[model samples]
Target chain A: MLELFQGPLFISILAAMVRIATPLLFSAMGELVTQRAGIWNISVEGTMLLGAVVAYVIASSTGSPWLALLVAVLACALLSLILSFVTIVLKSEQFIAGLALNLLASGLTLFWFQTYIIGRDPPKFAGFEAVEIPYLSDIPVLGTVLFSQRVLTYVSFLLPLAVWFFLYRTRYGLEVRCVGENPKALDVKGLSVGGRQCLAIMFGSVMSGFGGAFLMLGYSDRFVPDLIAGRGWLVVVAIIAGNWMPFRVVGAIFIFALLEAIGIHAQVVGVSIPHHVFLVLPYVASLVLLAGLRSRTHQPVALGIPYRRE
Target chain B: MAKAFSSLIVGAFGSQKALLGSLAKATPLLLVGLGTVIAFRAKIWNIGQEGQVLAGAMCAYWASLWIGPLPYLIAVAVLVLAGLAGGGVLGLLAGVLKTRFGTSEIISTVMLNYIVIFLLAYLLDGGPWMESGATVAYHQSPPVNAMLEWPTLFGQGAAKLHFGFILALGATALSALLLERTPLGYEIRAFGSNPTALRFRGTDISRLLLVVMLVSGALAGLAGAGELFGTSHRLRAETLLGIGSSGIVVAMVGGLRPSGAMLAALFFGALKSGAIYMRLQSGTPAGLVSAMEGLVLLFFLCAAVATRVHITVRSEAHA
Candidate 1:
């Protein structure tokens, strides 16, 4: 067990954690923007599943991971329209709308999976390979853990900084924040609250789509029904546990990624505990994290409330 | 397609056996849906019905081990109580999380669900509950003691409806009464509509939330117990998992009313029952039903919003 913490095993685990954090980084950053705009979009899970499914389909059929990623994001964007209507347009309960979208995604995925993928041998896709940068990749442990990763992983690593910039340093970012904190002010300013929310939702869903696509094409060659599993929900938790801040949320995402990486490596590390304990750690941690945080000062004022002319 | 549709109808209702089977299926759904209806009516959103149901069955199974010798009637009664206690306790836990810690019930319930599911997987896979035999161990408990099985109401074979149907019916009536004729029910509805007013009116909002979770979780828990003791007669996660989500769907489709949930449960029960025959007869995959559920839910959500306001499709003539 002590050996698990030392030597090459620890390095490999850190490297794996970095790789695993890629999809979550893409998702958490996107959801942070949407939540900042005061749109409590919980449909991240469903959108992720749709993204994975589309990625699997396009990658196998067209033989282009890039094309698959594009189509997957596009598909999720289209699906977000349904959510936008039910949530932003109808002004219904945001949670309920989110739940409905999740159910729809899983049900549709099951149907499609059974209809096509069940009987036939699944088609193989050309998945993303790890790319090694020249000098950066040679920088000992730090270099291997950070520089030598798939292309998308590198993109995701820089996403949070980009998000922090977008959310804090940009004009539209302030408007988005205003829409969440005081939609009435935005409304008074003659800015369209619903329109801002719609775009935010679209962006959030698209990023989740990227996560799902990467989960499919970045690592695996085939797709399964539970591919996204609870990662989407984990992304939502990351947003909240991070107190809805850009960097803090990234911190939370890495924590989850680290736990999951350790869980995956526990058996190989010769731990005495049952695998289930490790598998369940992230969820158990989420409860404890939420209970301990208790700070809602940073939460958006109208996060889940549907905005309407009063 | 038409033939497949007809076959599905026949599979669900053509024979007395099929009808009884469908009713048996509806028992758990109705129970869980009733639990959902009350909670949703109050807008509590206890989405952990899945875990609650599992807890209920697990509790009842534990009770049976220690029950020892007793009269048949008393034994069954104890088991029923155990079932309720199991689910109610889990619900109360969520209630505490919300009332004390300020954790959102939505996130907490969902997290608890994963925890419970993992716990069960542990229990069944290699923990004490794994079915012991010469063959590879399945992730399930040994068949429930046959002597303790809930008595059948009527019919025979796989379609024999168990006594849980009666419990479910009684629960429906009780839920209707609780929501319509009781003060607590009034408080629940009022809480959903306006929590601030209820607080001003001297309601202990925390207690109300706890009660809501307890009742919602208990109802779902009962469904799990019913599925275990009354139908499957074995403790298995696969049999119990979908009932919670299906119940939620039933509650939503029923417009979060007791009577409406009953009808939706029956409809979905039939859909589920018929899916088997539909697959065999017309080669339509059963997964289509699950997909249809999502579509129906999305449709209903939109319809509720659409129906709430009088859309002025045509403009009034100018004077």
Candidate 2:
């Protein structure tokens, strides 16, 4: 067991944790903002998947990661708009609408991939590559673990801080929070609750899009079916476990990523424990964390309800 | 494009064999949709039907192993009951968590879906229940005992339909009867319409939730059993997972009614059957059918909301 904590192994595990946490951080931060505004966008899973496919297709065809990321964000934002229209404009049930979007995304991605790319070797392009910070790379233990990452990973690390500031320090942030807690107040004050919630959903979806892009470009070489792999759900779980706080959401994401990284390392090192146990550790951990911490977390009062002008 | 469309129709229902195939595919959706209707009517939000189905399938498969030595009729009954219990317990856990700890059923159910799926994967992936000769690539349980299999209805060789279709129809009838005639059904509808009023009248909301979840989960589990005994003859992930989500679409498209779900399931099943045929004959991707299902659900949801809510257009002069 002591060998597990050796210099190289420890640093590598920490590095893997950081890498794995990047996408979750992006989506979780996004979800935190959306939830703060009182809309439960359950379509995060679907949006991430759509984003991954859009990014992969564009990147492979154009050979430009930046363009791919931009298109992916737009694609996911479009999906969020649909979700907003149904839930906010039509006043439909948020949960079912989100599930429908997920099914649509999954089916569309698989259909497009099969129709366009199947029966042939699809083109492959090197996605975003890791870059080391000039001065920080020389730091001992922390250097390789934190300083060397894809540009997306660096952005992900700073996102929670930015979200925290937006939520607490800005006047617009106060309106977003109020929209969730009491939309009637916002309506009486001549602010459009639906408009604010719409923007929040769009912002959250764009972040999820970036998360999906990072997953495909930084972690994987190709876009596979269901490539998001429930990371979107994990983002929702992280926000819940964190009590919807941006920094706390980061902590929750890191914990899940740590477990996932350890699970992968355990498989590589040929640990004697049952592989299934390791495989299921992160999911089980989320369940436990949710059941334990959810009681303490206060949800937005009108989180899932459709707000209307009275 | 017109030729391809005609062929798709021909592939789905042009022949007796295609019609039977569509019926077979619709059976599980109908059963699971009935289950979803019950829960949704009660405002339970049991979205973990996918996991419940897996749990039921695993349990039914396990039960079949021991019951094979008994009388065929008795064995089948035991297997069915076991499947129901397996799914019911999972649903009950979520319900209990919601009532006891104030957990959101939606989140818990969704999380349970993943947990149960992983558990199924663990069991099938060279675990104790895996077929002895199965390789790593093909994770599945051993074929269920022949006596435990649902008897086919028609077509001796390649076009065999199973008794599961009848079972699904019976479940639909039973659900409609229970929801419309019985006191429990009346109470369920009442709870959905006004839980506060029901609670005020001394009806136990938590207990009602538990019962609703159990019935809902049991129906989904029975669907899983039908798939195992009627169609696949073995426990596999691919056969089980898609039905749960599709069942939701069926339930919603049916307007959360049993009869409506039955009709919706038939339509979706026809599309699925036709898509398979379309893929084989005309090279259309089967995933398109799945997307169509999503589209139908989305449209129906929008319609459901639109009919109920009054959309007032604002004048630019007011601004």
Q: DockQ for each of the predicted structures, in order?
A: 0.73, 0.67
Writing each residue's lDDT as its tens digit, candidate 1 over B1-319 gives 7988898899899888889878988888999999999998898989888899999999988888788888888888888888888888988988898888898888888888888889999989888788887277678899888878888889876788989899999999999999999999999999999999999999999999999899999888888888888888889898888788788899999999999999999999988888777888987877777778878888998888777764433232322
| Colliding pairs, model 1 | none
Best candidate (score: lDDT): 1
Two-chain DockQ for model 2: 0.67
Q: Please give, for every candidate in the order listed, the TM-score of chain B alone compared with the true chain B.
A: 0.95, 0.93
Model 1, position A50, has a per-residue lDDT of 96
Docking class of 1: medium
- In angstroms, give how far residue B35 of model 2 lies from its true place: 0.7
Worst 10 residues of 2 chain A by lDDT: A290-299
Give model 1's TM-score for chain A to 2 decimal places. 0.97
lDDT of 1 at B10: 93
Q: Candidate 1's residue-wise lDDT over A135-197, tens digit each?
A: 999998988899899999999988999989888999999999999999999999999999999
List the candidate 1 regions with Cα displacement exceeding 4 Å.
B311-319
- How high is each candidate's TM-score? 0.96, 0.96
TM-score of chain B of 1: 0.95
